[model samples]
Target chain A: MNTLSYGLLSLLSHSPLSGYDLTLRIQPFWPAKHSQIYPLLSQMEKDEQVTFETVAQSDKPDKKVYSITDKGIDSLREWLSEPASAPVLRDELMLKAYCVPLVDPSITRDLFQSRLEYYRNNLQRYEEKIRKIKETSDLDEGEVPAYRDPLFGAYILLNKALMSCRTNIEWCEWVLSAIPQDHT
Target chain B: MNTLSYGLLSLLSHSPLSGYDLTLRIQPFWPAKHSQIYPLLSQMEKDEQVTFETVAQSDKPDKKVYSITDKGIDSLREWLSEPASAPVLRDELMLKAYCVPLVDPSITRDLFQSRLEYYRNNLQRYEEKIRKIKETSDLDEGEVPAYRDPLFGAYILLNKALMSCRTNIEWCEWVLSAIPQDHT
Candidate 1:
């Protein structure tokens, strides 16, 4: 099965949600486009992994809300137990760092400074989200029960991301200093 | 221009090399399949960004050694000055971390421990290569030159990779501790 399918199932396991809702909810974990999510939802429905019901509404168009099936939950649990594959870090800045000696030192300094800004902003955003999640009770946020709450899982993810940004900034500063000033 | 194309030019800027040789040289930065490299070489030659000359050898079949054109060098420098794009970190482990509360904690703990091992091995391998690179001078291993050397760029890349792997193993250990023992 596709990884995205499991992500959708995992989201539905929390609560029944529309395709649009799924698109927004999954962004923090997996930033997939809506175009990708809608088609996958239909495919999962055909495969009997997920089922959708059209909920009538007076103000908006009828929405097809999706929920995970028993098969989907079983599949998710199986996947969760299996080893997680390593990600290919197609990092462009790291790629640039590989070519920095060919360029002006000032260019690299600027790039590092910009990245420091970018990751600082990213780190701040994740920390704010983590704080918000913690402030709300499990019931208020529609979380899985405290025993099975996915927020705990999300917390671990956010914590790692926060740490990664911190590491990046530190490395960038190191690179800047390592390059000779007279070289520029 | 394709990122891979610039990577090829950057490699050629160091010295003229055959397609297979280029594949080996570029592996430390961007690992490309031989299939991908050969076709891109042909395409780049047609674009006037690269040119090749066939050299016959007494012991072996003729080999086409590729060198970057002036146009290619200009293109590479232009690209070097441009802002780097953010890579999509499609990290599956982080994705798994987002759902860990749904599975047995022992499974995640085991996965994290295994990952710690994997990255620790990776860090050691890169560190060894870095040490080897530092100890050797020209003729010891054919280096470009002290002036136009790519080793400086490569050193930065290796340092970052080493730090990244270290960070990953540390994070894995932290995750193992963060998960409550009773969760299993």
Candidate 2:
């Protein structure tokens, strides 16, 4: 399963946060929907992993200020201690890669060229996001936020993911060139 | 869905094949069980993608000899021409990479180390398969059997994935050293 729940815990471990804070800040990394959110929040509450107090806002939507319980802290701590699983490489690209050179070398070459462009676009996005963050935020080296910042981990994740996209593009280009260029 | 069906077309594009030959020769790259085999075979026949006729065996099990239809070739051609889907990278290792700095630093370090080892193992498996192919067949580079030949593309994919893993390990090690290096 997609580990949004774990993402929720990671958020709360930084500090008590509202559902709104989670939706804006953490959602960028984990990418959850309200459907996954409300249910997970209720389940976490039922499990006594978190407690939320209803907060009213004068100008905008009211919010639930959710705080990690002692149990939640322990859970996050345990999760942090446990070993991570192996990479689950479910690459549809691999399917395409296999089909090509056999079906029509011309088509395969064109497909790979397009994919290279896609990666280049992604790399641009990652670089832009990094630049924007650097200009806007006061992040120190490795960004050790003062005992209450989910953004720290998010920043690290973004950097790593960006590197991955760069590496992917580089690899894809190398592979594209290595295969004999066949237009037909 | 797992696109093992492509392997069948790839094989048949080269020549007619029996069901047993499919199970034996084609199953290794894109794996399937007996349960999945007959159903997909039947579906292909109804779709007029493949023609199957029973062939009696003198001493072995009777087999359905399957040949690609003209329509099948056209379908395969169209499939090759269509834009391939973007790679669906369900990388649990990447999530784990996010988890690493959040998780115990030492455990995270150990995990990457193990991952590095696993990648090497996979590379060895690929190498071993390639060697076995060479030993068993007199097939030259251009004359290689379609499904049986080593896909240089697959090698590049594996190579890229491994390089990413190695780079990740290096990054993890650097970060781990920079950190307090006290936690396990």
Candidate 3:
């Protein structure tokens, strides 16, 4: 889903928005670096999907507020209507684990153990975030926001995804302990 | 996860086998064609992670069987004991879909719809395969095979994956319906 491009169009459809506003709106799902942002923006302008107007700001430099063109609207509408392909799953770490017999034993062991720790830390962080979010003010976007909180379904997915991560961590531990180890 | 490569090495650790046998065992999770397979095999050989010997056969052409080296075993054992890395996801179709606003509207629509249809067909095929395999007399071997009978946990995952596909399909339809007819 040319996600970034789609995002630009989506935001513009609602209202003309600055790059900063678009960045914030898109961040929850479509992550983008400023580096990726500028190039794609330039590309979209060249393609006539979007045009920018200089907006005077009270502070800081003049901002470029982007609006979607008719062509852009047609494109996103077309995309939104289309079915997505099956997601491609590619985990290079799993592949490397499969080839563990080929590399240095200690290096592999160290790497795996480090990953285990990392996963633990990751789980901790997510737990903290989810807990904080759940405990804090209501998911109701003050009863009437332009967009409904994506969290309704997003949290459900987070549960499943988190469960999967925990399973992966357990699996990692299981494989580590069960496998016979002989340094010599 | 470099899963195929890692699996190939561990599989070799068990005993030397040809690419055909390896592919057959590996496909349930790590499906790879000759193009993807042979190239990686060549690279592993170059790295001395695997050793291969060509053997003559009576009723068939000669076969090249591969085996894991002692160093490979050490590496595998070490890797299993360590923690794994954070998984990174890369979905090309999603990326393309996200950027659809930059492409020609009709072209984007066609591509998106094609992908949707492809996913739907895959869902059907997986469902059928599950049913047929259940009706069959015997189950095969490997990690996924162990869960073949009477809707195992692995089967549950396949089902879950299927559900996700169906959900995505609905999302696509919703997106389609939301768009104006002129875009169509």
| Best TM-score among the predictions, by candidate number | 1
TM-score of each: 0.84, 0.68, 0.52
Put down candidate 3 lDDT per residue, B1-184, tens digits, no spaces: 2556776776676578887788775653455676787788878888888888998999999988888877767766665655554555434354444444443446544655675687688679778866665556354542232211223323433544455556556555543432234442
Model 2 TM-score relative to the real fold: 0.68
What CAPRI-style quality would you assign to candidate 1?
Answer: acceptable
Which stretch of 10 consecutive residues in model 2 chain B shows the poorest summed lDDT?
B142-151
Q: Which candidate order results from sorting by DockQ in descending order?
A: 1, 2, 3
Order the candidate numbers by lDDT, best to worst: 1, 2, 3
lDDT of 2 at A172: 72
Please give the lDDT score at residue A19 for candidate 1: 97
Candidate 2 per-residue C-alpha lDDT over A26-52 given as tens digits, one digit per residue, 9 for 90 to 100 = 543555567778788888989998999
DockQ, 0 to 1 scale, candidate 3: 0.15
Q: State fnat for each of the candidate structures.
A: 0.54, 0.33, 0.16
Q: Which of 2 and 3 is the better model by lDDT?
A: 2
Clashes of 2: 0
* Candidates 1 onward: DockQ, in order: 0.43, 0.29, 0.15
| Per-candidate chain B TM | 0.81, 0.59, 0.56
Model 1: lDDT of residue A64: 95
Residue by residue across A1-184, what tens digits does model 1's lDDT show? Answer: 6887788887787779999999997875667999999999999999999999999999999999998899888888898888877665656676666667777777777777788788888889987977777677433442322425657676667777877878887877777666556664
Q: CA lDDT, every prediction?
A: 0.77, 0.64, 0.59
